[model samples]
Target chain A: MIGRQSILEADVDTTGINSLRNGPDDNGRFGIFGGRFVAETLMPLILDLEAHYRAAQKDPAFKAELNDLSVHYAGRPSPLYFAERLTKHLGGAQVWFKREELNHTGSHKINNCLGQILLAKRMGKTRVIAETGAGQHGVATATVCAKFELPCTIFMGATDVERQMPNVLRMKMLGAEVRPVTAGAGTLKDAMNEALRDWVTNVDSTYYLIGTAAGPHPYPEMVRDFQSVIGSEIKSQFAEAQGKLPDAVVACVGGGSNAIGTFHAFLDDADVKLYGAEAGGHGVDVENGHAASMTGGRPGVLHGNRTYLLQDKDGQILEGHSISAGLDYPGVGPEHAFLHDSKRVTYAPITDDEALEAFQLCTRLEGIIPALESAHGLAQLMKVAPTMGKDQSIVLCLSGRGDKDVESVGKYLGLL
Target chain B: MTTRIDTRFAALKAEGRPALVTYVMAGDPDLATGQAILEALPQAGADIIELGMPFSDPMADGVAIQLAGQRSLAAGQTLRGVLGMVEDFRRKDETTPIVLMGYYNPVYSFGVEAFVKAAKAAGADGLIIVDLPPEEDEELCLPAMAAGLNFIRLTTPTTDDKRLPAVLKNSSGFVYYVSMTGVTGAVIKSRGAVGEAVDRIKSHTNLPVAVGFGIKTAEDAAEIGKHADGIVVGSVLVDAVARSLKDGKATDQTVGAVRDLVAEIFSGVKRARG
Candidate 1:
């Protein structure tokens, strides 16, 4: 009973700060996580970026331009559909899917990409660079670069390029020069290292459009601000559709942009429980086998910020494994670290098998195929929904469409 | 309170010649060969040494240093192992200043206070953490300086006059002026621009300014040394170690190869003012 009371008290604002969304205080720190941990070469530029972003936030013209593009270009107000069959089959809580996959470029990645590319244009940056894992962010960034008439380069691990060839082809078709990095395990970490190398070399002309909600200070904050549209829309649509807030909201967390975005709005509503699903490749208990940073990692600095990372005793970052390349990184976003520590959000590891099962179940039951990244969230929902009462409701962010993952999923399932 | 870095730089200032600073990854290829490489530097004409504390991810470095770090990690070099190498090098020589250079994660993971105490006891004179800027001085820089270790900061071409003070505020030992806006092992776009940047940095700080990044050979060292207080070289020497390795293991020529390059580059530093 004492433990249950403590869990109830966790909702109280212990920091005396009013809102959970008011994080990454001036130093880019969210309760000792997230800071500008980049090299001195990129420091001044980062400060300059923060200044521009602050001004852009204040300017009405900037908001109008972003809003205009959101509706007319990238398809804002992505549909919120109640999953009738999935809910009935689970026989407990009602399930609702936030349709981010139906958006342009087939994922929530475009939300951040569109905002960043607009900022790049405003900064007069002639070239763009980004690192990607599953190629969703890469394809989204390449899509924006083509629309903006800027030359862009996408650095991807050789392994990711091999596994995600469909996205590789899509990026190439969108006119991005995809540079395959062969360093380390040839994964997202190596790709990020290569992209940083390129950004440092071409600082004067290039803009690094970070794909995730991690990285240095302004990037985490800026990316979250761009992605907040997800939660904002969910708030209104859910209110109108059900006449009340859902009991819980869940999303898949990689570097955690989509989760942070979806979690940002409901954070102040203490009654609304927020959940995030992490990639548990084999299992969190197995060494070097999972991407569940919050579940299995400790606080360490990597990729320009302090976050939970899968590293060894010697502080060497371990290359994490996941069926979904998007969630294969060793670290999670700093905000998620803060949220996890603050107990405002519950993050659980969903194994690859569970996610695969949920993937097939959602496809068969709802007639909607979700990205493997999103399948992790559905797996979490499968666990939580059955435990809740029939009157309760849950919203799961279907972060991307599974089109790009078809071949990989097919191979894994022996259908190839 | 004077560190070996300060003493060595002051001594070279009196000698009217820029110091030759050589860099090598600690425990690169293997521990024994890396120790031999460190021991040979002073005699090979290196006035100061920057021992690379290899990390899993060296983001600011180019391909050569990156591969060298991989080779070092593969050979099982831990942060503790790097400190042991420093202790071993101090057994024979004490005048050549050693600055441990790398990113901040390994040191942060080693426990900042304990690592500082261990590093000072290990006879390391200074630090050159590439990721830690002035904003993060509270993390390691101030603590290190308080414990009598010089915390060197790197100033790139992009660090403008307005931002130079904050960078130089907690800076001691020296200001490492990156000659260009790029990672290690790159070709310098203009030699003349490096001289100007060095002069600009000299105008702000009394600390000896050493220029690094993109400096590959003796001739390049000579030209850059004419304007700066010291010349720093790393990737090319690491590349020499790489080229000498046969099937990823160090050969007999491994130590000799780096010594030969250091001797040649020192020759250039010697003739810069002449």
Candidate 2:
């Protein structure tokens, strides 16, 4: 078991966002690593976003509307609770949980989906297309598009469609078309492929609501910027709670949206520790199940931008496995690539067994069941919290509630 | 004659006609048929031959080329296998320059040093990695040059003056000017823009510049040939192979279609030269 004392004693710096704003394209892509790599058909739409996002950041009307929505609809200022019981039980450092679960849709995914859907409306796009695994992103997309009266198509892998039937139905009820993509491995990556094909076929009328901070240029940067609210909120929330930022910020990385969102605000904060928890299925071996791209992959181009990927000797993409459907992808976001290369963040992996153990522990101790994807981050709390004294603080982003994962957990526990 | 690519441009300039380049995916339909198409290209008025090494995912390519890649991969075509084809061709013909074209991952997987050495040893005169640009030169360009193999650079409409010089610096054999702003197999109605793009690139480098991406028909090739040093057609030929397969006569149809396009393009080049 990992200790928590080390996490609290870690330093917290908050200068990453300031540097990002000052960098190229007002986001941090050094060169070929970052740019908008959308098709020519969507160039005008993205350009509109480039203009609106710049304006919205400065516009009081936009800020006020977003603030109002966050407060009333999505439940703004999510609590920062000290995990005293967890810390004491683990016999380690102090731990604090940044409760993103309290948000309306019960996950950090809503933060991005809601923001992008609104941007889509502003851009005069009436239809939205999204890809999902575990149906978290699809549900979120369906939820937001419903609220906005925008038509949506959610592409889910046939495998995920079978596993996440409840969320699939929820998306259907929310009035979004649930497209079960049967190609490839019938997983998140396949869903993304189908979504891209749809976007290419319907580029004129549909807005591709990319679920994470991955894909080609502009998307990784754009999605990160939209999701950066998590980091920005955490900075002030942690400050108010502990009279300073937490020593470390830890979040799970699937396609890395949630991690990047939570990590971006602290990039330049040289003192603050940043940890990206990757899905370690069984182990790090190629054939062994794991989505530890940063740990196991080489620098290669995939999707749009050059990033790490699980590929064979011939550079053919290898299937990635993880208990969490969301984290079972071979490639990671490009910014994570930049961060890994620049040594700005530490990327590590948590095994499926470890995450499941953490999932059960958190549910038993706190009466809060976390999505398996978010459990990866909670698992890190056990690893990092035990090394420091009680004075140091560790903040773990609880990205989603686990209600959607009850059936899977039941089966895993042999209670189904 | 000078060893520099510019000297080849000078030679083509005295002829006062554009070079007619032909592109065919290696192992498309089957290895034997793809090889046969390659061998027959020079006789069909092809000045430079661009042979594609298939990849599973070709982001820059259209459906026609993508299908060709699928067929090639299904036939178990490897980079080594394609290089072997080049060796076989070199035994009989060596005057016409052969450029191996494909995505970067295969080469990266093959190990840059090993791939460069193998390509040079196999009698491959040049390489055209569609996805690799100046940004990724460290991966293959430097090693390829060290092995005495030409690294052809692709300059798209997006390649501005600011970025052109870097593209030209690392480039060898020739510069492949993508005629359109989209993927391969797209058709452009106007050649005026392509001519202007060729002129823009000419102002930057004196290398033999071949224009491709949307050159579908002979007229399109001829129009582009007026401005470019070489007119390259890809999708039209791949489409021919696809048509052949659909017709259940891929062997005869693919070769015959390529022959027809080559004759038309050659006639255009001859008219320009005269």
Which stretches in model 1 have alpha-carbon errors above 4 Å? Answer: A1-16
| Model 2 interface CAPRI class | incorrect
Encode model 1's per-residue lDDT on A1-416: one tens digit a residue: 01100110123334335677678788999999999999999998899888877776665577777777777778987999999999999998999999999989999999888888888988889999999999999999999999999999999999999999999999999999999999888889889999999999999899999999999988998898788889878988999998999999999999999999899878888999999999999999999999999999999999899999999998999999999999999999999999999999999999999999999999999999999999999999999999999999999999998988889889889998
The collision pairs in model 1 are none
The positional error of residue A330 in candidate 1, measured at the CA in angstroms, is: 0.5
Which candidate's TM-score is highest? Answer: 1
Q: For model 2, what is the error of residue B241's alpha carbon versus the real structure, in angstroms, after optimal superposition?
A: 6.4
Q: lDDT per residue, candidate 2, A1-416, as tens digits?
A: 11101111122332243364323344325443554433333344455556765555555565566667777888876888887788788786677788888888788788777667766876688799999988888988999999999899998989888877788889999999999977557788778866766665554578889888887545776677667778877888888777787788889998999898888778778888888899988988648378888888876666655678887667766668888888988888887877888788888889989999999999988888998998999887778877766777778889888888889878988998
TM-score of each: 0.97, 0.76
TM-score quality measure for candidate 2? 0.76
State residue B260's C-alpha deviation in candidate 2, in Å: 9.9
Q: What DockQ does every candidate get? A: 0.88, 0.17
Error of 2 at B66 (Å): 4.0
